[model samples]
Target: MKGISENMYCSDCGKKVKDGADICFNCGKEIPRGINKYITAENLPEEYKPISMWGYFGYQILFAIPIIGWIILIVYAIGGAPNINVRNFARSYFCFYIIAATLLLIVYLS
Candidate 1:
C-alpha cells in the first residue's frame, strides 16, 4: 500500500496505469509489483537487522588497536562472528589493512 497509488505509473515511461493491471497501457512495460523498491532493515527478514551505531564504532575501535586487533579481525572475517553484517565488516576492514600495509611496504622498500 505504501508504494502503491490510486493510479499506478509505469516506472520506465511515467504513464498512468490502471489498478490491478500488470502491464502499462501507454508504454507496454510490465507494471512492477512489490519489486524495485528500497527495503529497509525493518522490512528485512528476522535473521537480519541493521547494525547499530555503537556496534559499528565498537568494531572500529577494536580494529584500531594493534596485534590483538588483527587477531580479532581474522576471527570475525573467517565467520567467527554470528552476525553476517559484522562478518562482512571485519572482512572488509581486514582487506583495508592488508592493502594499506602493502602500500606502506612498497614505499618503504622503494
Candidate 2:
C-alpha cells in the first residue's frame, strides 16, 4: 500500500483510520503523522535564509530512487529548514527536503 489504504484498520481501537490522520478520531489513538504534522503551513518560517534555495527543486528531481532515496526524503522533510526567525515552515520544509536529497544522492552515488 502506498499510503494508509481504505482497508487499513486502526492498530489501537480496531476501527478504520482515515487517510492522513494525526490521531484516530474514533479512538483518539495517536497515529504517526507525516513531516507536515509537526507544524502547519501558517506557522512555518517566513524566509529561506538557512534553507538552501536549491533544496526543494533538487528533491523533486531525485525522488524517483528506491527505498533509500525515499527514506532520505522523509528525513529531510522532517528536519525542516533554517529560518531567519519568522518561522517560515513551508520554506524550512522545502529546504530540508532539498538538502537531504542532495546529501543522499551524494552518498549513494559515491
Candidate 3:
C-alpha cells in the first residue's frame, strides 16, 4: 500500500487535487509539472522581459490608424520587427485582418 496515494494537494491553496492532475480544480491554477512550463519573474531572462502595459496600448493605438498602421504592420509582419513577440503579434494581426475582410466581402456579396 506504500506510494499509493489517491489524491494530491494544491501547493498554493492546500486544496485536494486528483492524482495525476496537472491543474488544481478548486483554484484553477496550473500545477507544477503541468502541460505548460510555468515561468516566474525571477526565471525570466533580462532580454525577454515583457513590454510595458503602456507600450502595448500605444502599439494598439498605432495599429488602429490607417496608412501608417498598414506600413507598421507590414514591417512587423515581414520579419523587420526586432522582437519575436512583436513579430508574432503582427503576423496574427494580419491574419485577423485578412479573415475579417474575407468575411465582410462574403457578406456584402451575398
Residue 7 miss distance in model 3 (angstroms): 40
For candidate 1, the 10 contiguous residues with the lowest summed lDDT are 36-45
Estimate TM-scores for all models: 0.57, 0.29, 0.54
| Candidate 3, residue 32: how far the Cα is off, in Å | 33
| Model 3 clashing residue pairs (backbone) | none
Which stretches of model 3 miss by more than 4 angstroms? 1-47
lDDT of 1 by residue, 1-110 (tens): 46433455688888876665666788789856565343444445333566899989999999889999888889989988778898899999998998999999999999
The true-structure Cα RMSD of candidate 2 reads 15.1
Relative to the true structure, candidate 1 reaches a TM of: 0.57
Cα RMSD of predicted structure 1: 10.7
Better of 1 and 2 by TM-score: 1
Highest TM-score among the candidates is held by which one? 1
Highest lDDT model number: 1
Candidate 2: tens digits of C-alpha lDDT, residues 1-110: 34523344568798876555566789888766452233444434354334455754565555446666556555545554244421344345457768998999999999
Rank order (by TM-score, best first): 1, 3, 2
Candidate 2, poorest ten consecutive residues by summed lDDT: 81-90
